[model samples]
Target: MSPARVGRVIRRCVALLLVLGLAGCGDAAAAQTGTVTVFAAASLTESFTTLGRQFEEAHPGNRVVFNFGGSSALATQINEGAPADVFAAAAPANMATVTGAAAPVTFVRNQLVIAVTDGNPKRVTGLAGLTAPGLKVALCAESVPCGAAAATALAAAGVSLTPVTLEQDVKAALAKVRFGEVDAALVYRTDAEASAADVDGIEFPESAKAINDYPIVLLKDAANPGGGQMFIDYVLSADGVRVLTEAGFQAP
Candidate 1:
């Protein structure tokens, strides 16, 4: 071993160590200041995405992201250890499945509406209208908020129908009407309103008994509490309720 050769080998080892250290630091920083992912109900897609943008703007240091699906599915993901900062569910029962009975503010309430094609080819007007024989109807699957509410509304009206299909979520249920695949679908009034340009929504009296409340919360695994809590607060604020109300959700 010559002294010059030994020095060159030592220099290369030092350079490699420095590169590895820098890479680790970059990875750690990325993990520390990451986007806050929210597992949310499908019905909240429009409103939550709208608020997600506001949250990012309000907290420039953090980014807000959403994973929207059925409330039950969202709960399953959270319970299954998905990295989530918050969970917003269409029903408290669904939220409780993952978050437990911890106090959660009811952010909004949604009523069932009959979503029909833009021209309403079937002229479906109310809950009773669904009783018409041979009329195809689309309702959210039993596991979804809108579907549960629809069932309640139907029970309240003493009317029943053989639905063409049960969709996975409110969004899919609404699509049946917009695509003209079914004559009508039961969905949250807000969902129908969100697609007003494409579908017609029929309000009915029985919806009162079937209103489902939406609850939002900051999850236990939140990476960005600053942005997460702020987003939850905003959804419960007057302005947020106004947006929900305008979109056909009731104030909780």
Candidate 2:
């Protein structure tokens, strides 16, 4: 072949290879993007939603779908084979219920607080104040983490009183106070902070004894294991911690 012809042939081959290489790169990028369904505790709604947005922003083409509810209920769903990539529970006890999940890591801690109507109109002093005559109080069901924490705090405080209602989750309990259905509710400090416009979170000393540790793990049978692990990594990253801490979660 003439030298000019040989040079032209080489250029054509190089261009073809470049195109193939670009196509290969596109395929790999596509594989890395998908929706990661995360089943998380109700208390994590605000912070986890924020983290999910940040995660999606950092990983374009990827998505995060969250199912936020009571931790115990979430664990039951996971144990029953609900399709989920990640599980973040409000308590280790709930995390322990999952049969097939990566080793759990405590990501954050939350303490209980009395969520009262705005302006402290009830003059509720502390946990003991809930015992006053006709004082209605809402508490999380004992089966849920918030409820268990409330039980622990009440026990530690040595105060005994029946709540007007036992809600399924912290948010529901907080809602009781927000709607004025109850005089107060024992809820996570973060939940109260999230609803600051409607209620005031009253911190008490006994809450120290009942702080709940938040745990996260990737499900072993996750449909998108890689995406699951990536979301877990982001939750433990500095940026994730910043978001959680700013929202009243304590680093674990």
Candidate 3:
């Protein structure tokens, strides 16, 4: 081949190599992107949702998604092999069901409360007051972490009151108070505070027995492994603490 022809062939090979290099770089960038799914308790919905947004903004290349429900339900789902990277539970016992008390850490605390509709409906005062005759009350079912903690508090106080309805979750119980469907409902302080615009909280002495610590854990093989750690760290950070405190969670 002539010298000019040889030079032209060299230029064509150089352009092909450059195209392959750019394609490889694009593939690597795409592989690094993905969404992290978290299964958290219903009580954490507000704070976690806010925290999720903060996390997505901070980590630019990833997205954070949450599945919020009762602690028991969330734990059951995780244990059943749900595709989740993080689990933020409302109670240690519930966390134990999935994480088995090995790696979870308590990140915040909360206590039970007697929340009533606006105007202190029915003159409710304390735990003992819930047992009054003719007063409709709402409570979470025995299965949920909040319900279990509530049962412990009531038993400790020697108060036995039957709820008109056993809600599926704490928010549902609090909804009863917010809508005036029930005179009072036993719900977490955070739930009451979240619904403060619609209901009022009455702190009770017996609630001390019902205090709960929320635990968060990153799954062993998290799809978004580093994202889970970042989120957990953020929850323990200043911004996460602010959101949790504003939502009425006690400092851990």
The alpha-carbon deviation from the true structure for residue 111 of candidate 1, after best TM-score superposition, in angstroms, is 0.4
Q: Mind giving the per-residue lDDT tens digits that candidate 2 earns over 81-108?
A: 8999999999999999899888999999
RMSD of 3: 6.9
> By the TM-score metric, which is better: model 2 or model 3?
2
TM-scores for all candidates: the values are 0.83, 0.89, 0.84
Clashes (N, CA, C under 3 Å) per candidate: 0, 0, 0
Cα TM-score of candidate 3:
0.84
- Taking all chains together, the TM-score of candidate 1 against the true structure is 0.83
**Residue pairs with backbone overlap in model 2:** none
For TM-score, the strongest prediction is: 2
Candidate 1 residue-wise lDDT at 131: 76
| Model 1 error, position 8 (Å) | 60
User: Candidates 2 and 3: which is better by lDDT?
Assistant: 2
Please give the lDDT score at residue 209 for candidate 1.
96
Error of 2 at 62 (Å): 0.6
- The per-residue C-alpha lDDT of model 1 at residue 180 equals 81
Please say which candidate is ahead in lDDT: 1 or 3: 3
Q: Candidate 3: global Cα-lDDT?
A: 0.86
Give the residue spans of candidate 1 off by over 4 A: 1-34, 99-101
| Best-matching candidate per lDDT | 2
